[model samples]
Target chain A: MFEATQLNRRNETTQKLFRLALGGMTGILILPVILILGTLIWKGAPVISFEFLFTGPTKGMTAGGIFPALLGTILLVLVALLASVPLGVAAAIYLSEYAPNNWFTRAINLAIINLAGVPSIVHALFGVGAFVIFFKFGTSILAASLTLAIMTLPVVIVATRESLQAVPEAFREACWNMGATRWQTIRRVVLPNAVTGILTGVILEVSRTAGETAPIMFTGAAFFLPLLPQSVFDQTMALSLHLFVVSTQVPNMPEQLPYGVALVLISLVLLMNSLSIALRMYLRGKKKW
Target chain B: MTAMAPIPGRSTERSLAIRTSKLNLWYGTFQALFDVDLDIRQGIITSMIGPSGCGKSTFLRSVNRINERLGYVRTTGTIDVMGQNIMDPEVELVQVRKQIGMVFQRPNPLPISIRDNVLFGHRIHNAGKRDARSEEDGIVENALQTVLLWDKVKDKLDKKATALSLEEQQKLCIARLLPVKPGVLLMDEPCSALDPKGTEAVEELIWELRGEYTILIVTHNMAQARRASEECIFMLMGKVVEHDDTGQMFVTPKHKETADYIEGRYG
Candidate 1:
């Protein structure tokens, strides 16, 4: 080992380098988010207009609106939430409340964490093959929703599970002692206490579903779709897909409207995020859990 | 059941509210309880005092089967509450739990208004429907009054339960337990998490409710055992070392271990 005096210079330099490296890493990780958000506001804010928002896709370099896309995003997210909320939350309840500390429960939990890390594009492909080709539903809103549900299932499931876990064991005991049946306990005490957390998870998943592009593109994406969906089977437009189209395809002409859509999309994401935060806050406020 | 209130002046009946015979529990392969037996009489306060991890809580959970939810924990032997074997497959745990309520070591108030928190058990059990407003009001008042929390919390009943001080929250939990009209009350170191004043408040409440139901309390605080209980049971290494009148146990314990513990020889 070197003497204290001999190591002083190198140690000092190493500490400075470590600090610099940390700072550098933080910037690198956060740069894209800041840039994308900044660019969206800067480029998209001006394009916000009532008229542009009401119209449909235009050919070549003409002014168009995000009404169809917005409608589609809402529908797709709603359907996905509808499909996944019950199933994912139920799975979470099983994992946390019902499942034992056995290998089976552990395996299921591990699979869910892994599912969350799976690529969105892979989910898209699964949706296309399963819902569209094998089920013969055709490339439509139904396919897109199924794909998005699978994509967001992990988020909602984990959130629900975490919320359920957050509940004190005493609460469950209290419920049981109150003569509540098992399902009754889950429905009354456990679920009600866990609701805010579940809702938060749902809101977050909604935002995630809204932002996805490649998945939607894979299942039911149409670059210039103009129609509103009437059913799950009807092909529809969505906000995220439209934003991708506007950002990459029509960056030159009527630039303001796309930016407007970008701003709207950003607002939508922020709104969902804020909603998730609010639900979680409400969940936390009830205190017992 | 006419659970409008505890109905004061009703003659306290003599009965065994809970009985346990040769109870044993295992955490994985580790034995937590070894052939333990206990009896909780109606309308009396029974205190369980023991060192930490001496199966006091393990014994408490067996009362309501909350231990069943914990992983790899197994139990053998019979636990009878109100002459019903809770361990019987046909016996409904949730139903059994309702008959015997519990207050935890830590105060746990649901994230809701004080009113809703008090009404929690009532609403869940549907003891009285929402349309039964008069019964609801009476039940709420009775439960709150039993815990001596009525006057302080009445005005702010609509406020969130978390808004209350820690002592108030503990009282609210007691109030919640009241609506169940339970035959027996199990308190697992209920005052352990409270300050001296809060502990005194809970101790007073326990005495106040004694005539209405049986009470079993687990405590690590020796002075509390001396001050608050009539009959006290002491356990060591998951075995009941001694059981006798609280004053006698403290003054002249039956076992040397109990005497040594009273003198702080070994905890």
Candidate 2:
């Protein structure tokens, strides 16, 4: 009975065929990533130098380093994180811990999903209308970062809520039974456990913020800036926008220059993603429950 | 059993730790408790035994106002803890919870160190006050010893509480509640997650805890009820069938349903 019959043999063949198909599909998914990174490094490695990374773009964006753009991206990502992380985490805590299960909270949840679904171009338009024009910030880093923060708020909130919910109800019950207030329970028990997850979400937001070119295009990012931004109110060049300008908008731009900018931008995002994954693994290892 | 820090407001005037009258509860439209009237004595173990969905656990949770955590749950009638109606709007939930501690079916230790778990409730109750490390250590050792867990876990106080075995975790859960000096303890099948040996250990700990704290435990294990409790309560279909001395109830049940349940006719 244990011996393979004709039917069993056929079934095994079909299973093997399906496995191959699925593995091929996964390989197909990874193909573009490998190709893009390989091409960027292969073409861009020659252009990379100490001066090429730290100096401002020269000769009308055809040459020189991307220091201004690099600094601007960092500033934008940091400011966006500052604005979004606190607001998102607090909103998540309220929804998860305090909000009564009612239509009002359901509506708020629905609004968040819809907000996340809104197009980046629409967010760019909104940034122009609200932060830049209406709020009188006027095409500055503050305006762009706010737009990015709003766009990524849903991500942070959802991640935080999920992590908070992942903490077993038993822990909260244990706290509440001890006469610990909800705030006390959250601060002592809930938030500490959820921090690494929250950090992962924040890192995801950082990577996304660094790559996005549309939202900051009209709101803050300039095609070329002679000086790096000194404050949130200043317009600045970003890596993503610089890559775009060099690749399509600027004339006589070296082939490797755009590739180099793209390589740097991709590297930054990947590094952030790696950091987040590492952090999550570290924290998860430390946590027992 | 060493001298515990005196919990303020532990009045010895009243013999009854918890008194409930005409207690009715509902999960949305489905009523789970029907006129549950009980007077659990102070410093004794009272075990409620019943088939599933019989409102025994509901009654236990109601004592601590924990059932209200479910948004759809609706309860009526009064539950008095230390002579105060906990359901009264003027009564703060924190105060109600402070007066009563609960252990769940599964051991739920905070994902924190053993030392931290032992000190969690104490710190919360004593907000903005810092206890000396030695003093805190004393409290930890005392609580753990009371639960019969100190010797097993004494040296690893800084280790994660969740890393302990299920039995130790349950004991830790119980130990954490002690420093707050709750007037009553409610347990909902606290050993249901444990193996046979673990169940016996926790049951013995509960037995040992009697006369020091009033503990109301809900159990499906008939033998556990008989062995651990001083008084016994039997309920079926959301109504109490009998409440009597543990030995007397098991030997000769007052009601047919109680007898039928005790004999394991159907649970």
Candidate 3:
């Protein structure tokens, strides 16, 4: 009886200890996210202004605006979306809907899963090597966009595949039973049903590309673009690369300038993130029953 | 029993909605169906009844070539629908299935509104007749009325289909099939998932649908086979045990196995 009572007491203590440990670990994990956002607000809020958003890059020692950087970011993210959305979704449909449980399909899926886990900086290096050097885009906005497009392509494909897969097999079978051709079933039934999921994935990939700094840094992020890109052929300075140069690597700049660039970059990312969330919510609202 | 069966020696007024000659099916190396010969005549409910894994559903699917969609499944021999060989590589299954509609065990409605669910195939095959179809919303209304779902879902035509009750959904599936204007309806245990009331509704629909569509049903319920169907094909171990009119098969089955199955001796 004593041993039994002792065992129960020990188990209770251990269980309570585990709970405390887990709770603490969760707090620890959340600390960085909170701290990151908190610091961005603290350091970046003061520089927030209408002129800072609208005006062009500074001349000489003037703390000027980030319009050129902002333009590059917008153009590059848009280009990436245009490049990846259709191809990623098509690849997803092929994998999820068309590919049966065969070895070739399995291998292709495994390859995609592995590709998603490859480090972001390596993707940048590959972009510089392939797009900038080989393709001879020569550090232009087009090259940066292409690099970012490749980086986010895998994310879009995986998300799209999952969404397409979520469209119940019953729906496809229903289409088939109705005498719909295979392609017709995909177009009329499956694709429309999975559109929301596909849209959500595209938004997330767009978010990812919007803030990516390292890849653009090597491939197309010009140190100081005097003018906003009027065409894809022009070199451009994206906000992420600007934030990097201003905050950490600006060798001969005053303290407040980095804060201003950091503010603009943070705002851009937060906007993209919020837009992605709103898009998904709006889609969910439309999904009746 | 032999005397009861008029068993015409030589008759040639051949009329079959669907006919299978030595139907065999394989899933990889394992055979799922044996050499099975069967015919479905018009204006009657023919049921394939057997235990689980007995390929009753397989035979039903064979009639419409639905099994061919499965990558591992392979079928041999000829399944003829309306004198066209469904097994032939040249035969367009899309066209064949357009004439033979199916309602599965579970109700599956297109995720669109109730109106769209009924008119999906109608719009597909009958596009040139759209204005006529739209004017005759009566086809959708009448189909729903026949399935006993018109009263339940009459006001919610534009509402999402997934919100319906299971019985209503099942009936909607029947209503959905109506717009396709199929001559043969295949049901793979349509009422197996339903409650008593839903089962009764489906049974009544099967009875009500006598002239327009010939039905091939797969059922585990012996009483359903007896009450709902006119012709019965009893199968076990992937082989047909007996084939007869439901009344005769229930009363005086020639095969001992058939009698055992019908008499609740064993499946």
Candidate 4:
């Protein structure tokens, strides 16, 4: 009865065939990433140097470095982090811990989902209308970073809420039964355990914010400005915009210049992602049931 | 200053730990507890025994008001702890909980150091009045000693409480409640998650805790109820069928349902 029949053999072969096809699809997904990284390193490594990283672009478009653009990207990501992390984490705590089971809370959750689904280009337009024009911030770092913050808020909120919920309900009950108020339980127990996950979400947001070109294009990112921004109110040349300018907008640009900028930008994102992964692993090892 | 304050100078043994009258509870439209009028005496181990969904656990949760945490739950009744109606709108939940502690079916130690778990209640209840580390240490040692866990854990008080064995974790759960000096402790099948050995160890600890605190525990294990508790309550279908001395109830139950339940005819 346990011996494989002709039908069983056929089923086994079909399963193997399906596994091969799925494996091939996954290989296809990974192929481009390897190719992209390989090409960038091969074509762009020579252009990366202390001088290339530290000096401004010269010779009618691209010959010097992407120092200002690199600095601008860092500033934008930092400012966005400052603006979004607190707001997103607080909103998540309210939604996950305090919000009653009612239609108003459901409506707010629905609105958050819809906001996350709105496209980057739409966010750019909204940012321009709200911060740049209506709020009179003008085309500045403040406007662009605010736009990025708004774009990534849902990521932080969702990750934070998920992590907060992941903390066993028993822990909250233990606290509550010990005469703890909800705020006391959340402050003492919930937030401490959820912080690592929240940081991972914020880091993921940082990587995305660094690579986004559209939302910051009309609001803050400049095409070819070589001067470093002194304040949030100053127009800055971000790496994403610089890569675009060197690749398409500028005349007589060097062949390796755009590749070099793209390489650095991707590396920064990869670095943030690796940091998040390392942090998550380290903290998870320390965390117990 | 609060109206929920206890009446002074009542004899401890005769005074009620918990008294309920016409307690009706519903989860949305489904009623889970119906007219549960019970007098759980103070400073004694009273075990409630029943089948699943028989409202033994519900009655225990209702005493501490923990059932209201489920947003759908609605209760129309009075649960008086220490001669004060805890269901009164004027009574603060924090104060109610401070006077009444609860332990769950599964052992739940906070993912914190053993010392911190022991001190968690004392810290919250005494917020803004920081105690010296030395005094806190004494409190921890005393509480752990009471639960018979100090010898095994005294050397590693700073280690995570979750790292302990199941028996130790349940003991720690009991120990954590001691620092706050709650007048009543409600446990819902606290040994149900343990192995036979662990169950015996926890039962001994529960037995050791009687007379110092009013102990009301729910159990599925009839043998445990018979051996560990002084008084026993039997409930079926959300209503009490019997409440008597453990010896009398086990040997000569007043109700047919209680006898059938104890004799293992049906849960």
What would the per-residue lDDT of candidate 4 be over residues B182-210, giving only the tens digit for each residue?
88889999999999999999999988888
| Total backbone collisions for each predicted model | 6, 1, 0, 0
Q: Is the docking of candidate 3 incorrect, acceptable, medium or high quality?
A: medium
Model 3, position A228, has a per-residue lDDT of: 74
Q: Give per-residue lDDT, candidate 3, residue B93.
A: 75
Q: Tens digit of lDDT per residue, candidate 3, span A1-289?
A: 3466877899999999999999999999999989977876787677768777888767542477888888889899888888888789889888887778889999988988888888889998999899989999888888888988888888899999898888899988998888887787888788877878887787778778877888888888887866777788788988888877776665567676766777676667678878878877887777754
Higher-ranked by DockQ: 1 or 2? 2
Greater lDDT among 3 and 4 belongs to: 4
RMSD of 3: 5.2
Model 3: lDDT of residue A190: 83
CA lDDT of B178 in candidate 3?
84
DockQ agreement of candidate 2 with the native complex: 0.83
Poorly placed runs, candidate 4 (over 4 Å) = A1-12, B2-13
- For residues B24-61, could you state the per-residue lDDT of candidate 1 as single tens digits? 89999999999988877767888898888888878887
Candidates in order, TM-scores: namely: 0.84, 0.95, 0.92, 0.96
Global CA lDDT of candidate 2, please? 0.89
Q: Between candidates 1 and 3, name the one with more favorable TM-score.
A: 3
Model 3, residue A276: distance off in Å is 2.6
Cα lDDT tens digits, model 3, B77-129, are 88877666777766677767777899999999888888888888877776424
Residue-level lDDT of model 1, residues A22-140, one tens digit each, is: 99999999999999888888877777777667777666525756778877887888888889999999899888887778898889889999999999888988888999899998988
Which of the CAPRI classes, incorrect, acceptable, medium or high, describes model 1? acceptable
- What is the Cα root-mean-square deviation between model 2 and the actual structure? 3.0
Report per-prediction Cα RMSD to one decimal: 4.7, 3.0, 5.2, 2.0
